[model samples]
Every structure is written in C-alpha cells, then in structure tokens.
Target: MDATTLALLIGAGLVGGACNAVAGGGTFFTFPALLAAGVPPVAANATSAISIWPGHATSLFGYREELRRHAGRLKSAAPAFVLGSLIGAWLLSVTGNGLFRQLIPWLLLAATVLFAIGPRLRSWIAPTGSGTLPKPVIFLIDLLVAIYGGYFGAGLGILLMAVLTLIGLSDVNEANAVKNALATIVSSLAVAVFIVTGIIAWGPGAAVLAGAVAGGYLGARFARWINPRILRAIIIAVGLGLSWIYF
Candidate 1:
C-alpha cells in the first residue's frame, strides 16, 4: 500500500475505535476509508472486520468490571452469539455479498434512525416494564441480533443495547458493557472464518488494528470521565454523517 493509503487506514482506525468505544459503529468509518483507498467492496468489508477485532477486544477489556458482574447474563448470551456468528460467516463465505451490498444503505439508514430516536424509544418502552420478558425471550433476541452482527456488524452495538433495554437493563453503561463483550465474541468468530477463507487484506487490516488499539484505550478511559448524554450526542452526529455519505 502507498503512504496515503496507510495514513488513511490508521486515521480511520483511530476515529472508528473512538466511535466504537463510545457508541458502536466504527465499521462505518473504517469501511468507507478502505473503499476510498481503492479496496474492493467485499475485500474492504472483510479487511475492516479483521481490523476492528482489537478495538472490540480492548473495549471489552476496559469493561472488565462490568463483565465480571454480569458473567451469568453474558454466558447465557454467548452460545447464541457464537452459533449465529458461525452461521452468518458461513453464509457470507458461500453467498458472496450481492444481497448485502443492496441491503447496506437501507440497513444503515434504519440504524441511524433507530440511534437518533433511541432515547425516545427508551422512554416509550419504559412504562411497559421489562419484568415480562422471560429468559427465552432474551435468548431469542440475542440470537437474532448476533446473526445480524455476524452478517454485517455495522450497528450491532446499538441493536444489542436496544434489545438489552427491552429485557431490563436500565443502566446504559451496563448495557454497553454487555454489548461490547458480545460484539467481541461475534466479530472474532466472524473474522476467524473470513481469515480462514483468505478473504482479508492484511495491509490495511494491520494499520487499522494498530490505530484501533490506541483509540479503543483512549476512548475507554475517556468514557469514565465524560457525560453519557454528550457521548450519545456525538455518536448520533457521527452516525448521521456516515449515513449521509454512505446512504
């Protein structure tokens, strides 16, 4: 890769990692950067997937305390995520990306809308009470969400948070912690599949991996110091900007 492409990869990774640490959607940034750098669409997606794994790991590690507290819940969700991820990865490897290419813009648009109106949705759902959602319901939700993550993974975090809220996580931080852990598992599994298939481009992936690690660490540290409302606003703004460009 040329110097410019290398720079773009690192810069995209840093920004994407920060966004992921805060709200989750770093793929939006890195994927476009890869595409702009002249990588093919499928290769870019696979490369972006490989690159973000470290950031996901870092973010999950940063939430270790929360993960410890929620071990049982996380365990309950893991099997579903793993199963879904394998299926999704297999599907991607076999089917090619024709369908996903057409679906991406609409998926991004919907994800953006959900994110922008997330607070309102939370308010609307609050009165219904989460006590009614059984464990089976939660598992089902996680399974479906993981399938989506395994397939594309752009806004998986947002989708996870929304599902977790429905199942009774009132604290956004706690929900975020779970989201990160589950996302790590799903993405890791998907990346493994892609790597085995030789679908990943190593050059851009390595650069992004370096930047994402640093950015994830910084973002996690900053998360402890920042107000979540402001963080949410920033995430929404970034998501909107990406949607405008990509959609």
Candidate 2:
C-alpha cells in the first residue's frame, strides 16, 4: 500500500477504535475509509473485520471490572455466542456478496433507528422483566445477535445493549461491558474465517490494528471520566453521522 493509503487506514482505525470503545459504530468510519483507499468492498469489509479485533479486545479489557461482576452470566452465554457467530460467519462466506451489499445500507438504517429509540424501547420493555428472563430465552437472543455481529457488525453493540436491557440489565455500564466482551468474541471468530479464506489485507490490517488498540485504550479511559448524558449525546451523533454516510 502507498503511504497515503496507510495513513488513511491508520486514521480510520483510530476513529473506529475510539467509537467502538465508546458507542460501537467504528465500522461506519473504517469501512468507508477502506473503500476510499481503493480496497474492493468485500476485501475492505474483510480487512476491516480483521483490523477491529484488537479494538474489541482492548475495549473488553478496559471493562474487565464489569465483566468480572457478570462472569456467571457470561459463562452461561458463551456457548450461544460461539455457536451463533460460527453460523453467521459460515453463512456470510457461503452467501454471495451481492446480497450483503444490497442489504447493508438498509441494515444500517434499521440499526440507526434502533439506536435512536433504544432507551425508550427499553423503558417500554422494563415492566416485562419483573423476574429474570429464562436462560434459554437469553441464550437465543445472544445467539441471534452474535449471528448478526458475524455477518455485518455495524451497530451491533446497540443491538446487544437493547437485548440486555430487555432481559433485565438496567445498568448501562454493565450492559456495555457485556456488549464489548460478546462483540470481541464474535469479531475474533469472524476474523479467523476471513484470514483462513485469504480475504484479509495484512498491511492495512496491521496499521488499523495498531491505531485501534491505542484509540480503544484512550477512549475507554475517557469514557470513565465523562458524564453519561454527554457520552450518550456523542454516541447518538456518531451513530446518526454513520447512518447518513451509509445511506
């Protein structure tokens, strides 16, 4: 890759990592940057998936305290997530790219709407959870979300957060922690598939990975320092901006 392309990839990685750490729309930045840098759409998507793995790992580590607190739930949910991700990744590989490309813009729009009204939706669903949701139900939701994550991870965290909220996780921090860990798991598995298929662009992947790690670390730390309302506003703005771009 040329120096200019490398630089753009790195820059996009920084934005992606930070956004992912904070609000989960990093692909909205990195994917476009990759396309602009002349990577084919399918290759760019594959490469971006490989690059963002480190960011997810960093974000999950940053939320280790919250993860520890919910270890039991995570353990219970792991099988579902793993199974779902594998299925999702396999489906993506088997399905032709044409369908995914046609579907993505609409998916982004739907995800954006989900993010925009998620809180209100949570409130509406709040009363249904006076008691815990059955483990089977939770597992099914996890599996479904993991499938979506493996297929086209844009705005996945928001979808996970919504599911978690409906299932009785009222604390945003805890929800975010779970979202990060699950996303990390799904992305890691998906990357493995992409790499095995020889779809990843290693040079750009390495550059983006470096930037994502740094940005994720900083963003997670900054998240702890910021006010929740401000953070929410920023996340919503970023989500809207991404939606516009994708649309």
Candidate 3:
C-alpha cells in the first residue's frame, strides 16, 4: 500500500474506534475507508470486520456482570447465533466482487436506517409492559440478526440491542451487555471464516486494528466528557452521506 492509503486506513480506524466507543457506527467510517483505499468490495467488508473485532472483545469485558446475570439467555442464544454466523460468513466467501459491489449501497442504506431508528424501534417494538416473545420467535429473530452481522455488520449492535430489548431487557446496561457479547460471537465466527477463506487484506486490516486499539483507549478515557447524542448524530449524518455516495 502507498503511504497515503496507509494513512487513510489508520485515520479511519481511529475515528471509527472513537465513534464506536462514544456512540456506535464505526463501520460507517472504516468500511468506506477500505473501499476508498482500493480494497475489493468483499475483501474490504471482511477486512473491516477484522479491524473492528478487538473493540467488541473489550466491550464484552466491560459487560461481564450483565452477561453473568443473563447467563441462561446467553446459553440458549449461542447455538443459533453460531450457526447463523457461519452460514452468513460462508455466503460472503462465495459471493463475487461484482455482486457484492452491487449490494453495497443497499446494505449500507439499510444499516444506516437501522442505526438511525434503533432507539425508537426498540421502544416501539418492545414497549413497556409488553410480554416476552416466545423462545422460537426470539431464536429466529436472533438468527437473522446474526446472519446480517456476519455478512456486513455496520449496524449489528443496534440490531442486537433491539433484540435484547424485545426479549425483556428493559435496563439499558443489561441490553447493551447482551448485545456486546452476542456481537463478539458473531464477529469471531465471521472472522474465522474470512481468515480461512483468505479474504482479508491483512496490511490495511492491521493499520485499522492498531489505530482502533489506540482510539478505543482514548475514547474510554474521555467518554465522560463527550456528549454521546452529538456523536451519534454525527455518525448518522456520515452514514447517510456514505449511503448516498455509494448509491
């Protein structure tokens, strides 16, 4: 990679990581940066997943208590999540670049919409005093979310959070805890497939990874000072702009 490409990738990663920590929607930055850096569409998607994987791990660690409290739900959710993720990852490995390119704009727009409406969707879909969804229905919904996460994953957290809310997690922190844990599982399984399929662009992925680690640390230290709503608005704007550009 040229110096310019390297710089772009690292810069995007840094911004993406900070956005993720402060709000959520890091992929809106990192995925576009990879595409602009000249990575092929499928490879860029896979590389972006790899680049953001570590952040999920750290987020999961921060939610250890919530995870423990929801241990039964987590246990029940794991099998479906793993299966869906593997299937989605394998599908990506087989997809041609041309096809993936054609799909990119739509996928981005959908993710953006999902991110934008996430909080409202959670409230509307899982209103207070609503009964919990049946186990099978929850499994099906989670499986679909896992598949999407494995495939592109820009708004995976929002989707996961919505699901957690649907399943009776009214507490924001508790929902976030399960969301982070499930996201880690989705990314880990998808990344393993991407690695085995040799689809990742390691050089650029490494750049993003290093920058994300640094940015995550920085974002954490300054999180209390940051207005998350402002950060979230910025991410929503970026996602909309990128979606329009790709379209």
TM-score of each: 0.89, 0.91, 0.82
Candidate 1, position 192, lDDT: 89
Q: Higher-TM-score candidate among 1 and 2?
A: 2
* lDDT per residue (tens digit) for residues 42-81 in model 1: 7788788889878888887678898898898888888889
- In candidate 3, stretches whose alpha carbon ends up further than 4 angstroms from where it belongs are 108-130, 217-245
* Candidate 2, 139-241: lDDT as tens digits: 8878988888888777776667667766667666677788788888899998888777787778777888878888877767767776766666666676667
lDDT of 2: 0.78
Q: Candidate 1: lDDT of 222?
A: 69
Question: lDDT at 161 for candidate 3?
Answer: 55
lDDT of 3 by residue, 36-90 (tens): 9888888998999999887767655555677799999889999989999998899
Highest TM-score against the true fold, candidate: 2
Residue 218 in model 1: lDDT = 72
What is candidate 3's local distance difference test score? 0.75
For lDDT, candidate 1 versus 2, the one ahead is 2
| Models ranked on lDDT | 2, 1, 3
